[model samples]
Target: MQADNVTRTFEDPMLLQRIPSAFLISAAVLVGMEVIGFLLLCEKHVYEITGFSVSESTWGEANEVPSKINDECAENAVMSNKEMTPLEALQTADFYLLWASVCCILVPQTMLSSLSKFFGLEYIRDDSFLAGITMASSVCNAVGRVIWGLLGDYLSFKVPLCCLLLVWTILLVTFPHLSGFEGSHLKALYSLWVCLMFFCLSGVFVFTPLASNALYGSRNMTINFGLVYSAFIIGGILAAVLTRIPQLHGQTFTQFTIGGMFCCVAFVLCLWLKDPKYPNKLKNLDVFFWFREYISLRCFHWSLGRYFRQCS
Candidate 1:
């Protein structure tokens, strides 16, 4: 779904423009967080939200499990870990962790790229429902790539990222309120919301691994991307911690709050970012426009460097 050629072109300016250029990868990560958060808001999306909502809604009231804190989960009165045999407990815990991992990583990386495609299968959510949204997402995704790519080319990466983050902020924070609407209005709102969600996700096009190089610096291409990719796993691990709190169990609010907060952090971090200089983009917009940007404060021989120098 992400294009390397396009990413390469914008990498220079993106790295130069600290706001959006820096958020390129962060946007992808935040989107994953967004999906996790959105899922938390909908009971239909997560079987775990029931427990989380109950727990968070009544913070004082203990929900079945009493010792509800990280690492201390075994101390809880209900379903105490002491009851299980070492092997049985380990197996159960392993499965729980594995499933949590799937929920975390899959929702962001795969769901955005492929789930809708699968939803298109006849046996899935009634070919009628999935077909429309899935097809629309794919079509819009293709169109957005060009539009966003060009924007990254001419304008600052800040424009696209801030707008996307702002929209994402609304999406993450207000998603819960949407449920208040009734009937076809609710469905229509949800449909439109989903489209907007996809729109923000297009930020990934600008922030792909190819783009990461220009923003961070191409000198350490392999290492930078390697570290960035690790974020997915790390984010997944954090998701587990956020979702499986003993009290909240698996609530939509847990994920949503976490995602909302993460998005804010990404946005803030982007404020300090700068764009990389790649004059080639102007000359060969056809070629470099679609290429990736490898970024680093040191790499930008442009405005971003001047800002860093002044800050120091």
Candidate 2:
């Protein structure tokens, strides 16, 4: 009888009509919350918050700064007005390199996160304690994003990103070896490792967008960022494939070592990555140009051989 009633509920087109009062109540609650939010959270101008008044004369006076000073400030500022179109950015070597680095760095975090619960259970026998550890890692994830974003703001994105990835690599590589402690020591170390992994993982999210904005410019930021973010799909697929490896099953050391290797590659890529605003002499020595030239030479040789054969 219960199964028949469940089937009727699934098949009934008028099920919503029967629950119209519940639906209406939920909708009303949502509308009320939205109304309250709108009232409390409306946007305000800086002047409104600071109680500053700007007269026409004050505005005119502000614009009277010397052109020479403006030029000097523009030269000194780290922010660049120069921007590229999405197509133009796509053509650059930095774009693909950044994408690859993002993919490599993301794999370690994604794989560890998916297997963390299982790994934790191996060290900490209590399911409830492991759940709490997971919750703490979640909190660390949120906090780390804000902290790392601020660090990026102060140091520029690349430096902080490199540092984070370096530390994350070390942590991943050493995590398995460090799990040999007993009792409370085991739980504490396990929780700390999980939380720190999550914390370091947050920097990838913060720095990627910041780096994209800095390198690619804000002109087509959304599209360019979407292209970069597509690396996560690749990373996720790679992580899933790694997890399914029969040898890696229950083998913590081998699994994390592989993950660490990916992060190490990401670190090397980060080292190679250049700041567009302050490009160095090494910019001309990129692998991309070398590969392009190599291909061009191969094409030239093939064409020359074809011409000689035609003459013969």
Q: What is the alpha-carbon lDDT of model 1 when measured against the actual structure?
A: 0.49
Q: How many backbone clashes does candidate 2 have?
A: 0
User: Which ranges of candidate 1 are over 4 A from the true structure?
Assistant: 1-127, 208-211, 216-223, 277-312
Best by lDDT: 2
User: Candidate 2: which pairs clash?
Assistant: none
TM for every model, in the order presented, reads: 0.45, 0.69
Candidate maximizing TM-score: 2
Against the correct fold, how does model 1 do in TM-score? 0.45
Error of 2 at 233 (Å): 2.1
Candidate models: Cα lDDT each: 0.49, 0.79
